[model samples]
Target: MKEYSIREDDLTGEAIAALLRLHLSEMHQWSPVCSVHAMPIERLRAPDVTFYTAWDGDRLAACGALKQLDARHGELKSMRADPAYRGQGAGRAMLDHLLGVARARGYTRVSLETGRPEPFLPARRLYEANGFRECAPFGDYVADDFSICMTREL
Candidate 1:
């Protein structure tokens, strides 16, 4: 039986530290753009960002965040599923939960920036399956062959 729960919370210093380490050391092993490597976890804990962690029994299975860019806009951030649970639909579950939160909060649009690498194909596919489409860069992102920008209107 697969049981899991998703909830928004302030990823504590310890949890955030561990996540940052995995994102930097493990994920970066395959990703070329490791910009999130330098971001302090406190940034995600900011007033505008709502971060969520998914747990399967006390173990963290996945996590993601929705950052309120403005009144009607939000940006997806730090979407990662534990490598151990990668193929179990945890990522998709986290994504659907985040989108529901954004929609319920009245966001008019949601955008995300993901890598353009072979390892990122699944991530991009997940977004596309949920209706995200390629778009011009927004927020602090710029045009980079390695970074693919995507957006979806609510």
Candidate 2:
């Protein structure tokens, strides 16, 4: 397997935009319109959101983001691995990097909202393996049947 590196990313790049579009498309397919929480590229560009991408040299392998919700809390957003890079640890690497960033920023907790459907099982599993557990909705999110919220204490 090729080695990949994760770094802060500018979402305006063409390759990054394409990856985000794919992530949004997948979210829409598996989640109801009202429950789709995937952030748009424009939203990810907001000042409070720090976006990162994993690259295998010239190839964009995955992406994720951390959105500051408060002094002690952060939310994970827009995590996705390129189809070609799925199961190759790209998503895990991106997630780990974002978690590290959250810790470095002095966040005491990290939370995420993801779909509850079959398509999202892998993501939930990934978070679970990383010590995230089911939690009530945090920040501005509300409890919903289509969404599962998870959190971890940093």
Candidate 3:
């Protein structure tokens, strides 16, 4: 498989729409608390949220977001690797790239909320492999039985 490159400029309107569609079609059912599942593409764009997209050659392979919660804290949002690229390390690469961006932006802590179902095992494992540990819910997320929260201190 080809190695992917993460680029800030790749996060465009069309790319965001594609990502949203992929998330809705495949990953929405994977999470009970995924509010963005049916959200409009335009709504995903905001000043507080910065997005990144991974590219394999000219193809968009994955995308993720970093929402600045505070000067030293950020939240992971909309992390989705395309179905065609699953199990090819694109998801891990995107997470690493997002973390690097968060650290560069002076964020001391980063956290995420994902489902706790069996289908979400790989996602939790990926977060753990990247230094994220189980933590109490942050941001607007509450302590949900169907959701698992993870945080990493940079």
Candidate 4:
């Protein structure tokens, strides 16, 4: 099995920034600007959020974030696998790391908002495989044509 060095990250460096930019660009392309729920770097830096990255040696393979919503709830954010590193396990690695952190933090539930477009199918599949199921809108999110809300209980 392949092992990746996944850890809480500082969200610095050019590679990380480029990955984030590409993530946002793709999100905007598939969904209306208003329906885009992907967080900006600034929002990911909020005190309630913890960001992480999966590294394949010196390369930034992927990144994701867990945002605290309440005492026992969290929201997944900004999960993206670098295009250059696609087909690798970086996205799954980052996700498992984030879920581990959430479990350690005693989060009883974790939720996310993603697009309903074709581009988001792989992500939806990943989440579903990890036990997240389509659910009603969570946190400040509302049900909409372009939005797909999912949640899982710890």
Candidate 5:
């Protein structure tokens, strides 16, 4: 298997910024403006969030984040695999990395909100494969047709 290096990233590089924009653009396209839950680069920079990026040599393969909600909870945020890197295990690698970080940080649970549209099915499937199960809205989220919430115990 091809190797990837995943590490905590500062999100300041041009490539990383572009990837984040792509993630947000795709989310906005699939859901209404108000329903788009992907965080912007600014929000991802908050002190409570740890963002990461995966690289295969010089190429940016994927990115994701773990945001502490409290002492025992964290939320997965802004997971995205570059189009060219899809099916190359980039998404799984990023998810596993973030989950490990959450566990190391003492989080007993991790949850996320993702779009409910057809374009998001693969993402939901990925989370399910990693043990996430459907749940009611979490954090500040409320029930919405455009969103689906999932959670998993660490």
Candidate 6:
């Protein structure tokens, strides 16, 4: 496998924009419009969020973000691996990078919200494999059949 490098993204590159568009498209496909919680580029650029892009040399392999919920908690947002790079460790690399950022920020816990449909099984498995456990909704999320929330302690 090619070496993957993760970097904080400014969300200004064309490749980044294209990847985000693809991420939102996939999210909408797997979940109802009302249930889709993937953030747009503008939201990912907000003061409390940090966006990252992973590269396999010159190719963008994945992207993800972490949003500070409070001094001790953070939320994972918009985690998506490029279709061409899926199952190639890019998602794991991105997840690890974001979690490291959360730890560096002094967060004691990190959580994420994702669709509950079959299309999301792989993502759920990835999180579960990384020490995240299903939990009650956190942040502004609610208990709904279409959404599942998971959290991990730093």
For each candidate in turn, the TM-score is 0.89, 0.97, 0.87, 0.96, 0.97, 0.97
Clashes of each: 0, 0, 0, 0, 0, 0
lDDT value for model 4: 0.89
- Over 18-128, each residue of candidate 6 has an lDDT whose tens digit, in order, gives 999998988888888788899999999999999999998889999999999999999999899999999999999999999999989899999999877889999999999
Stretches of candidate 1 exceeding 4 Å from the true structure: 1-3, 13-16, 26-28, 31-38
Q: Where in model 3 is the C-alpha error above 4 Å?
A: 10-16, 33-40
Q: What are the per-residue Cα lDDT tens digits for candidate 4 across 9-53? A: 888778888999999998888889789888888888889999888
Candidate 3 residue lDDT tens string, 59-151: 888888888999999988888888788889889899988899998999999998877779778889999998999998777777757777899
Clashes of 6: 0
What is candidate 2's lDDT per residue for 1-154, written digit by digit as tens? 5578888888779999998889999888888999989999999999999999999988999999999999999999999999999999998998888889988999999999998888999999999999999999987789988889999999
Clashing pairs in 4: none
Give the per-residue Cα lDDT of candidate 3 at 109.
97
Give the per-residue lDDT digits (tens) of candidate 1, residues 1-154.
Answer: 2656998877774664686668657556765644432244778788988888888888788888898999899999888888887988888998899999989999999999888778889899999999999999898888877788899999
Estimate the Cα RMSD of every predicted model relative to the unseen true structure: 2.2, 1.0, 2.4, 0.9, 0.8, 0.9
> Model 4, which residues run further than 4 Å from truth?
none
Worst 10 residues of 2 by lDDT: 1-10
Ranking, TM-score, top scorer first: 5, 6, 2, 4, 1, 3
lDDT score at residue 61, model 3, on the 0-100 scale: 88
Error of 3 at 92 (Å): 1.1
Write down the lDDT of every candidate, Cα atoms only. 0.82, 0.91, 0.79, 0.89, 0.92, 0.92
